[model samples]
Target: MMLFAVEWQPPRLDTGDLARIAARLRGLRPLESILDDIGDVIGDQDPPAAEAPVLAERLRGDLVRLEDVAVAADDRDPRVAHLVARARALRRREAPTAAHPVTVAHLRRLVGAAEALLERLTETGTLRACA
Candidate 1:
């Protein structure tokens, strides 16, 4: 049997509803990358007709969670806020192509956005236990 590696979903956005919009300025860890990776993988899947939309919607919900956390935390740092904006744009772009044109470059861009957010959070200590 081919074994699939189990991945853990970080708890940055779910740390706390209130903490979702907070501050961090020390170099710790990056959580955005995790979110992005999750989205990229989900968006790139070729599930059966019954499962494709469900997977897409789940991925969208995850992105929305990050967006909500970022918006809540934007008051803490503008970089995080900007990351949120980029993620939102990517989400919108992915929605149209969820089951059609899932390109490698597109995946890279999505992951890149997440990486950028992680770097900012790590440098700023916004993602500690969350990462």
Candidate 2:
């Protein structure tokens, strides 16, 4: 009988990769804040004219940051791509009016999508602090 010894090494992440992951984790805070603002606007009977555009712009910027991190990490998560696409679509729309229920619904979905993406990233160890 022959005995064989096998060596196992843990996966390695470079400093740049860790920095990107940390940045992504930090970016989640602003995304959550934007989602909260969107929810507040949705709760209102009449959302202010200027507020929606500002929120939408903020959301777009946050999504762009997330997308850049995802791309740098070579993340293949479908939800991340979908979330980016949705944010881009929302960004392209004219300022949403209180009368447009569909737009409100889309905003709600976008918030949900952002939350989902954040959860997935956290779960995948991609949002962990650099150690």
Candidate 3:
């Protein structure tokens, strides 16, 4: 029997790739506010059961888009990877019936990760506009 192991190599992001990532990050920023508004609505009153699921689905879509950018950027940061995994898990667990509390928490974490990644890009000089 032969055992083979494949090593994961991070892709080198070129100038154009970095620019695209910056644009994606900018796009994701609006989702944070959307999530906050949904959270507030959930907290303020008893809304229809369908409301949360709709918001959760939207958040899931945003997270998936962010995840695509992170993977493209070849982000190796442990925190970013963890958040991506959480987002994936949340997406997998999404149910049409109701929104789970865990989903909300994951969305918050994913948003934070997006912010952190943007900051990381700036710190590494990958995103000059952000700096």
Model 3: per-residue Cα lDDT over 10-72, one tens digit each: 899999999999997776655345445345434555435555556556665666766776688
- Give the winner by TM-score: 2 or 3: 2
Q: Model 2, 28-67: lDDT tens per residue? A: 6644564465465557563455555565566566556556
lDDT of each residue in 27-60, candidate 1, tens digit only = 3224444664455455646344554445455544
lDDT of model 1 at position 112: 68
Whose TM-score is greatest here? 2
Name the runs in model 1 displaced over 4 angstroms.
Answer: 1-62, 95-102, 129-131
Predictions in order: lDDT: 0.57, 0.61, 0.58
- The TM-score of predicted model 1 comes to 0.45
For model 3, give the 10-residue run with minimal summed lDDT. Answer: 122-131
Better of 2 and 3 by lDDT: 2
Between candidates 1 and 2, the lDDT winner: 2
